[model samples]
Structure formats: structure tokens, C-alpha cells
Target: MSMPICIIVSPVQESADEAIEGRLHLVDSHDPQVPVTDLGVTRGDGIFEVIGVVHGRPLALDAHLRRLANSAAMLDLPALELEAIRAAVLKTIDLDEHREELSVKIVVTRGVEGTGVPICWVLSFQTDDHRAERAEGIKVVLLSRGYPHDIAARAPWLLTGAKTLSYAINKAALREAARRGADDVIFTSTDGYVLEGPSASLIMKFGQRIWTPSTAQGILRGTTQGAAFEVFGRLGFATAEVLVGVDQLAAADAMWLASSTRLLAPVRLLDEHDVPVDHDLTDTVNAALLDTAR
Candidate 1:
């Protein structure tokens, strides 16, 4: 494994004219940086974004930054200096020696208790090879997300749409999927509506239409899924974001989990039921996604 590159961004929010380069400082990834009293560590009060890099290019950067900002607003954290964050991300990517494929993570946390300031950092590391999952596909099991489809609207404080550090439940869901002999999980709302995977977005094809569960249901708006939608639209597939019932998974021609690092992995089996794997189409979509990075 390679040593990760880390860049600390002091005073996360700043004016454009402010010297951003002065604010970004390289740090040792192996050493402890975050304080124990930080809200992000104690209460999981923070927002984050991951950007995939291919051939030295960051994928869907603008979309990722936008989502980061949205998450900040949802958490009521201080406004982020997006331009500065972008510079830091690019700098970290440039500093990283491994250039084949990389995952860049941007994290902003409500600072240590009693401090109104926020803490931020940009880290870059090599990504795992996901060719097998993309080629052979993955087995998935459906699990209840323990909320209704309208929970985001009913309980705004739940922070459904934000990409925060509170991923214990998501990790537990994956473990549960493993116990059930599956590679991943698709969360369903209490009302029987399909949600998303633990760390990926669910994209299903029914006939010529490609649909992803609406983000309105409190799922994080998938940046990679948005890029995949563009590719599907160009290929003449009718694309949409709408409410989908859990029962509808059985009727799909094909399905896939879309994420930043893995790119796209077809779901071959849903709840032990064989789901179609469109290898050629999957390759075509993956090619486009990789090409965008180039």
C-alpha cells in the first residue's frame, strides 16, 4: 500500500482574493491530525465528498463540490470556500505519486467543542481495482432503511441528504448483506420504496428506460450516477429519477451500483434472484466514464 497524501486547509471558508496557497499545508497521513474532541469524531457532525481520479484527471469535480456545499448547508456548518477546496484537491492529486487511479476525499468537520471554526482536509490515495466487480457483477440483498419515503420531508433534522461521517449504520448494512451471502445491499424505505446501496446509487433499466431512486427520498445525490445518466441519455435511453417500489426490482432488465471509486458495478443477483448482466452495455458506460477523466 502507498502512503496517502494529505493537505490541511485552515479557515476552510475564505474569499477568492485570499491567498489560498498559503492556507493549504501538506501533512503526514500516518500521524494523528484530528483532535479527539472534534465534533466530527465525537458526534459525526461533518460533511464530505469523494472524487475519483483517472489518468491524473479528477472525475465529476464540479458536481462533487456542489454536493459538498449542499451537504454543508444541510448540516448548518460554516460556508465552505469551494474554490480553495478545489485548489487543494488538485494540489493533493498532483502531489500523489500514484497516478493510475485515485480516490480524493474532501472532509469538513465542525471543529473541536467550543470552537465555532470548522476543520477541513483533502486526502488522495490509490483506489482498489474494481474490474472483477464491473465484469462479473455483484450479488446484492435488499434491506429496510427504517424510514418512509417521505422521511426527508417529515424530519429535516435527520440530515438524510447530507454526506456526513456517520456511516456506522451503512457499514453495518453491508455486514448484514455479507451475512446473507451477498456482496452489497440495496436499502428500501419502510413504505416499500427502493432507496440506494450502502455507498452507491441504484440504477435500474426497465425496457429502454434507466431509472434511479429519487434523491428526494433523502439519499445522497450520486455524482457518478449523474454522469452515468448523461451517458445513458446520449445512448438514447430514457433516463429518469423517480419513486421506485421494492417489488419493481424483479422486473428490471438489468441493474448496477454507481459510485465514485468503483465507477459502475452491475448487480447480477438481487436477493439470490438472478438479475441480467449486460456486459457490453456496462463496458460502454464504463468506457465513457473513464474517457471523461482523460
Candidate 2:
């Protein structure tokens, strides 16, 4: 049997003609041309966004731009000209020869010379995945509390809220799950408060209401999480940025990990506990979100 197909587009380019007001005049916005010997390659000096675009439109793009700028601030990179970046993205998608439904990753590396001094590149990749599974739900393994580096305090430095390229820990969490036979991992605080998945936000059910980890929980505010909560209001499901424990998760009628690509995956399994799926609630929420996404 063939393994599932995962799309990969490399060296995505940005427009050089776009004006940053100050960055450049009539610049071609070339891909990062720094030598393979650049210092950032060894020292990770960039920010990025894994955007999901459908029907040639980006989802929550403005929100993503806000987070991107925040991430750049956390890393002390140059101030990101949001409008310019947005235009570049729109232009890039228009240039994308492959038009199938795709998820695009928008990336911006700190300019090679100084902070916002010399941009490495603003790259975006358009991918095609036929086997993208909107999982029935997910099997989330609860991992240790708060980040190993006292993320609670140093999060501003680490940009917990910003979706940056420094995802070594995130990758390791996913690998640890794969090795142990699970789909994804959920980081939990010692008190059992849920944080988030390696790459997605944690959404759980509490009775007829919805709950997610608050900023105090040090979870990155997810775009999908934001969108879903909007639906929660319309659907009359009480939603809050509250902290939840595994026991609460086990007690809820449903659970899910929401993201752009995953959309809202019903989490049927969490660690050793097997959750009884509520297809009705899942279906309702999915339809509502899909409608809103459009």
C-alpha cells in the first residue's frame, strides 16, 4: 500500500515590486539569497504562518498577520509591514499554477544583517493533499505541564502566542506520540489544565458549553478556536477562555482539536480514555464552521 501523500512546495517567492514604505523601493522581494553559511540557519532567526487557503482565498488571513507581527516582536525582528505581506500572499496565490484546494505556509525570516535589517525571505508554499483526513476525532496523549523552560514566564521571549519557525519542541511532541502509537499530544499543566496540541488548539466540551485554555494557560490563541467560539455564540453554546483538565475532558460529551487544515477534528480518543463520539454535535459545528469559513 502506498503511504498517504503529503504535498511540499519549496522556495516560495514574494514580489519584489511591492513597496514596504521603507524596506525597499521597487524591490523584487527575492527569495532569501543568503549563503547556506548564513548564521540564522544555525541560529533560527525567523517567524512564519501555516495558513490554510481554500477556493483561492486565505482563511483568517488578517488574524494570521497580527500573530505574525507579534511573533516578530517576540524575537526582536524587524517590524513587519502587514499590508505589504498580505499583498505578497494574494499575488503569490494568483501565481500558484496548482489550483486544487491547498494549505499554504507563509514564512518571513529576519533579514540576514540585523533585526529587520536584511530579510532572508518571505516564502509561501501551496500544497495538495488528497488524503487529508478530517479525523473522526483525535487521540490526544496528555504530556507534561507547562513548557520545560518555564514557558509561563519566558513565553513572551519564546513567542508562545506567535506561530514561529522555532518548532523543535512541537515536532518532538508529535514524534513522541507517533512512537508511542497516538495521533497527537496535548501538553498539560501539573494541575491538569490543558494547554494545546503541538500544532493545533485544544477545544473541549463541558456539558452544553465549550471551553479552551486561556492566555493564562499559555496557549496560543488559535484562529480556528476563535472562529469556532463565534459559532458557539450563535449556537448558544456557552464558550470561555477557561482552563480544563483531563477529567473534565473525560466528563464532557465531546472533544476536538481545531485547526485550519484539520478544521475541527472530533477527538474520539485522549490518552488511555476512549471518548464516545457525538456525531450530532460534531456535524452541527462542522457545518456551521464550514459556512462561516466561506
Query: Top TM-score: which candidate number?
Result: 1
Kindly provide the TM-score of model 2 when superposed on the true structure, using C-alpha atoms: 0.81
Off by over 4 Å in 2: 1-34, 37-40, 113-132, 145-150
lDDT of 2 by residue, 1-294 (tens): 211122111222245664453332222334334555443564566777766666777778887878877777777765666776676566555555542355666666654444335343433354434123343566778887455323656555656666666788889989998987888888877666678888888887877778887866556778888888888788888999875765677687777787876677777777888877777776776677666546
Instruction: Give the range where candidate 2 is weakest over 10 consecutive residues by summed lDDT.
Output: 1-10
User: For candidate 2, what's the RMSD?
Assistant: 5.5
TM-score of each: 0.98, 0.81
* Per-candidate local distance difference test: 0.93, 0.66
For residue 136, give model 1's deviation from the true position in Å. Answer: 0.2
Residues 64-86, model 1: lDDT tens digits: 99999999999988888888899
